[model samples]
Target: MSDFTDASTEPDANVSGATPAPEATPEAGTALDIVVLAGGISHERDVSLRSGRKVVDALAEAGHNVTLRDPDATLLPYLAEHRPDVLFPALHGSSGEDGSLLDLLAGLDVPHVGSAGAAARRAWSKPVASSLVRDAGIAVPASIVLSHESFRELGAPSVLRVVQRALVGDLVVKPASGGSAQGVTIVASPDDLPRAMVDAFTYADVAVVEQRIFGTEVAVTVVDSGDGPQALPPVEIVPTDGVYSFQARYNAGETTFFAPARLDAEVSSAVAEAAVLAHRTLGLSDLSRVDFIIDSEGRPWFLEANVVPGLTETSLVPLAIEASDRSVPEVYDALVRNAARRG
Candidate 1:
């Protein structure tokens, strides 16, 4: 049902614009008090909590005194009273991914380990990030955005017909500004388009309906540690149900991941460069992850970028760090140190 090809097995080639990162040293950030923000009021609260817990453990293991904190009413007052050395936000979705909360953190002069407020806003919206990357000469899927009000007032049936006519192929419909793959549907037939649109609307006010290009789904995690951002080995995702839904992303063993995706050297290099370009083009800071679906022609199509990449047990970013020859604590420690230095 996909346009998959055998081009992945070709020999390795030098990835252009990708420089190897320096060896990670864990001593840069030691014995500092850190707060891991998690458990936000988003559809991904549980996932965020898991990520926060993992980060707390990693930072604690790296010799930092870390505590997990939820975004509660008392959060601001608490931060004002006792400023931690660094704040590592492991929250995902809405308030966490969008610029609002980070802006508040900035107002408090809180040094957090992720993108700044404005850049997160740019990267949080799927349509905005896709347009920026496409304009940057990266190949992105052709898609259209629809608001719930327009879909309802203009009539769902009519809109569906127009959409089907415009994107005459398999399609992937998802919320325009949410993550963890919540409210995402793959519509292989016109009959399912309306249902997918409704499902997407439940997650966000706007939905992005993009043409589906079948090949391989990979997540490229980009991390920065004082030096410029660098792309880690891409993680290829293979879901049993053929879609990387929320269940596949959080549930262990529900999806199989291959680090350093089984792509020929040339294709691998291209994917890495695309990820890095997306990061820089989006103006993302600290860390991010770029998702893509490589078409049969061996071209990687930009899917969406995550300003706050997941770091759960089953998350791709942690796996990417491992593949990069660094322990999770080492990378996280360095990120905390970098943020503290900037602060």
Candidate 2:
């Protein structure tokens, strides 16, 4: 049992005696202590900063004692000293999404508004995440992992032979660990494989080459708030360039988003359920967004799980929530409510 009862569930900190270690007293009425993480050594640092700003503003408006902090060297010391009740980690990619920071949070014994350390680490690597999810009974497209160092030392001829033996036609090659589509390429022919490999290697040591699935691309947001986990409505992605690349994700006018996606009720429900299942199976906590590909047979195939997914202006979760008639502030509040309970 935790020393502090989750704030959302406990009637009050005074009643439960489960408030965080800091000297946090309610001002006039009820006040929650919130620490939102914005910056990290990630390629998506700017986006994470924006996400932290939005989350901090919303939580502050919701009458919480909010603290916004970047994961600078001072972060651990600040956390140790302040002991805020809840931490909202809004970081993206690399150090933010990897398990290391989450592990540090575990050491602090603080409740964060995101996935657990193990799950985040697993999902940070594309190939590993895909394999783990698929083995857990989720359908996934065939994929392969290639090492750039090995390719360089052993040469491309042998690597090419191995990849051809392992995968089939039309592949998506991307950095194994990074996100926001950094250094990702779609190779339709053998001639493009070398260039794609080099491009992917620029971002990460390992690259993932996945067989393309013919279907709709969608993302489902899942939140676990002690009531157990549940999935939000699905968001269908249609990119103008026929790929949901970095530009499509960030550039304002490059893609069209459809919420509750144009799928049958049964299929939609199945996808949502599958997402929740994946979240639980990975042992992630609080929240995560599961990406998928709906095949020609109308079956959903798991692509990857984002433990600390993007939460920017053009992010998908807010849109999906709005499609369900939930406002952004309301959604943010729900996370706070859940974080309180998580304590």
Candidate 3:
């Protein structure tokens, strides 16, 4: 068990014209037994471990009995015997976000903090999620989803020709179902497209080649303690190297973040509204982070939605929480109590 310590930091003030969510009612000062699962065999295993540690520390500071555990073969048997009051999964990548583990937890009648299995499935696949959000009136970038097998059978030359014709601009290629920018590449030149596809395929069987939307990149975190889900302040991402790669995300000084973003009042409100709409449209619960790109015209384009967003020291969610004038412990505490009540 990791020692519990206060991890709250003073972030920049909330974005102008952004209304913070109302403080959730506490759970009568009752400390409950909580198990935080982390460290899966996914490519994001290290990130998941870091996020899990952060969660464990915050929950412990909130007066809960927290235990940190890895998701291994013995996990299910351990849960069956111990049955903590609530399970808080800080896992990332496919192990946690792909809905397989969530479904198993549901089968065991475990009350975990996150979206349900069905909702997680909808948000895991980039193509499916983009389509669903687009149907709900959100603007998603035009892209093509290709399977590795299809890319080989159809011949790379033919596929690249069609892709270039369809998306006539700088393109961004990434794995169809993963996060933390593990296998993402920006293709400005046509010669880079084939290599980008191979990089994306290294992470997942399917790859998404999308039109690179040039603008400010921001991430909005939505939290549902007990009341309906509400959007937190948006966190603008500015990487020193120009690309928010895996290093920029977890490294301490590789990127600079502007909490609540630097957009105007009207645009800020619109971004928050769009985030909430995307959350509702995807049927997500507990907590989620929706990413977007704000064009020069002030239009918010949906990039992706994360059901289990990172909570590490340098993660955007923590930055948004502090920017909203709320502590990480407070937010995590409410989620645990809410999950227990639902159970």
What lDDT score belongs to each candidate, Candidate 1 first?
Answer: 0.85, 0.79, 0.89
lDDT of 1 by residue, 147-216 (tens): 9999999998898889988998899999999898899999988888888998999999999999989999
Of candidates 3 and 2, the better by lDDT: 3
Highest TM-score, which number? 3
* Candidate 2 to native Cα RMSD, angstroms: 8.5
Which segments of candidate 2 are over 4 A away from where they belong? 1-29
TM-score of each: 0.91, 0.88, 0.92
Candidates sorted by TM-score, best first:
3, 1, 2
Candidate 1 residue 55 Cα shift, in angstroms, is 0.2
Give candidate 1 regions above 4 Å deviation. Answer: 1-29
Ranked candidates, highest lDDT first:
3, 1, 2
Error of 2 at 26 (Å): 12
Candidate 2 structure quality by residue, lDDT tens digits, 213-272? 879999999876667887988999988889999888866767888887888998899899
Candidate 3 C-alpha error for residue 189, in Å = 0.3
Report residue 170 deviation for candidate 1 (angstroms). Answer: 0.7
Off by over 4 Å in 3: 1-28
